[model samples]
Target chain A: GAGVSQSPSNKVTEKGKDVELRCDPISGHTALYWYRQSLGQGLEFLIYFQGNSAPDKSGLPSDRFSAERTGGSVSTLTIQRTQQEDSAVYLCASSLWAGSYNEQFFGPGTRLTVL
Target chain B: AQSVTQPDIHITVSEGASLELRCNYSYGATPYLFWYVQSPGQGLQLLLKYFSGDTLVQGIKGFEAEFKRSQSSFNLRKPSVHWSDAAEYFCAVALGDSNYQLIWGAGTKLIIKP
Candidate 1:
């Protein structure tokens, strides 16, 4: 079985540029999550998708950040205009289902550097 | 809002010595507790979780955690630590009604000495 995978292990971009990060969850996983990890900081929850239900966007920092999960398998996190503060590792995770009891598997993550 | 706290920013333990990482959480009602380990340049690996039933939970790699409701704590412990155990440990809590969103701690960095 394959684990969660993310694209562009490392990305360097200028400030104000837009970037799209992709995540492919494990086969048959119905719960997807996105998180941001900054240096010396904890993992910050970004967004989450559970099957066909509405995605939880409360954790998204700003309006510039958005995510879409298509066909309940792949998820794309988009940053419209990146800022220097947005420089961090973006991690994706998935579980069999969205619940408090299920364990989530994580991806290697994409390190985004805004210069 | 649910929150987790890892009071120790860093801890160093000699190899073959007992290890304990303190984790305290704040949330209304019973919450789901978890401990995860993350090596440098790698994704997080779940150490253990406590949802209900037994307060003591065992996880992979000889790790275990005790969930104490009286203190609102879920501390991770291991009888002995290996050098490979050096990594950042995170304590997270999730409320059952929050759609599974986790509130994470600042993390504690564990260092192993020979």
Candidate 2:
């Protein structure tokens, strides 16, 4: 079976610009999550979606960060007015369900460099 | 707040030597524990997980983890590590709640020396 996949393996953008990272989850998966990884900060959760339910966006660092999952399969994470501090690898993951015990499959991740 | 702790930032082990990565978690209630491995240029792969039942859990690639509730720890172990086992290992915990948001550790870089 196909695992989770992400697009734009690498992205370089100037500060103050906006970036969008895409994620394609496995078929039949009902839960999708986004996380960011930096040199100092291991991996920080960004947002998560479970089917059509309301997304849990508490992990989003700021209001500029937002994510949307369409049709319960693909997800897009948008960072508005990106800052140099936002330079990091954005990872996406998916699981069969949203339960705490479900095992998540991760994507290769998209590395975004804010210069 | 839920949090995961990986005390060792890096560890080196010789090929064919035993390996152990310590993980401690803090949560209000019983937590869902997980260990994941990430190669240099690959996505994270699950090593094992502890939800309930048996405290010892086995995972792919000859990896296993034992959950100890008394210490609130879930440590990953491998009998004999191969050179290819060098990578970053992360410990994560999910709170026993409806959201199930995961709290991740800083990750430990595993180095294998021949």
Candidate 3:
């Protein structure tokens, strides 16, 4: 009954620095996703992982953004050389599996501020 | 490309008044529609989803949504709103294919007035 959880409720870093955001999905969940929410904007898809399959990186804005899900449970989203434009709330979500019908449970999110 | 639109940037309704939030989506095929709400500094909570079968779907907290294929819309509605209902409402559409990625709207901010 535990929902998804994320770490570092808030993060402040300088431009060009790298930061790693963590996500702990619900037990038995096989799909994890990362998204970014900018002020006055919609949630922007980042990446997604389904079990052990190759992660879907199509939504990743650039090569500097990457993510890894370990043991099909926890996921980490890393943004290398962060830019001011990358400042936003990083949200993580997970579902029973990757499908159009599955409803995703979201975490509180990590607000990353690039100064 | 799949996309979602929430035309209203913000809406205000008195407590106990009926509410409706419009959502329109663009996709090649039938889409999986969803409505989510987010309070300030909180995560998104699923209010309802429309996948198949009945066009009308009910969700938690007395919320419901009706899917209208003719209008390409899935609008969320509630008979009466509470003050606690004030928050940001988002409309999203999931891909019908393998990716399962969600295309989200800019979101509509709901303001509950006494």
Off by over 4 Å in 2: none
Where model 3 places Cα greater than 4 Å from the true spot, the runs are: none
Q: For residues A1-115, what per-residue lDDT tens digits would candidate 2 score against the true structure? A: 3899999999999999999999999899998889999984578988888985545788999999988888988888999999999999999999998877678899999999999
RMSD of each: 1.4, 1.4, 1.3
Identify the runs in model 1 with alpha carbons over 4 angstroms from their true place.
Answer: none
Judging by TM-score, tell me the better candidate of 2 and 3: 3
**Against the true structure, whose DockQ is highest?**
3
**Model 2 residue pairs with clashes:** none
lDDT of 1 by residue, A51-85 (tens): 74545798999999989999999999999889999
Using Cα atoms, each model's DockQ against the true complex is 0.70, 0.74, 0.77
* lDDT accuracy of residue B54 in candidate 1: 94
Candidate 1's displacement at residue A93, Å, is 0.3
Query: Candidate 1 — what's its lDDT?
Result: 0.92
lDDT, candidate 1, B1-114, per-residue tens: 678889999999999999999999998787888899999878899999888999999999999999999999999999999999999999998888455888899999999999
User: What residue pairs clash in candidate 3, if any at all?
Assistant: none
**Which tens-of-lDDT digit does each residue in A1-42 have in candidate 3?**
388999999999999999999999999999888999999889
* Maximum-lDDT candidate: 1
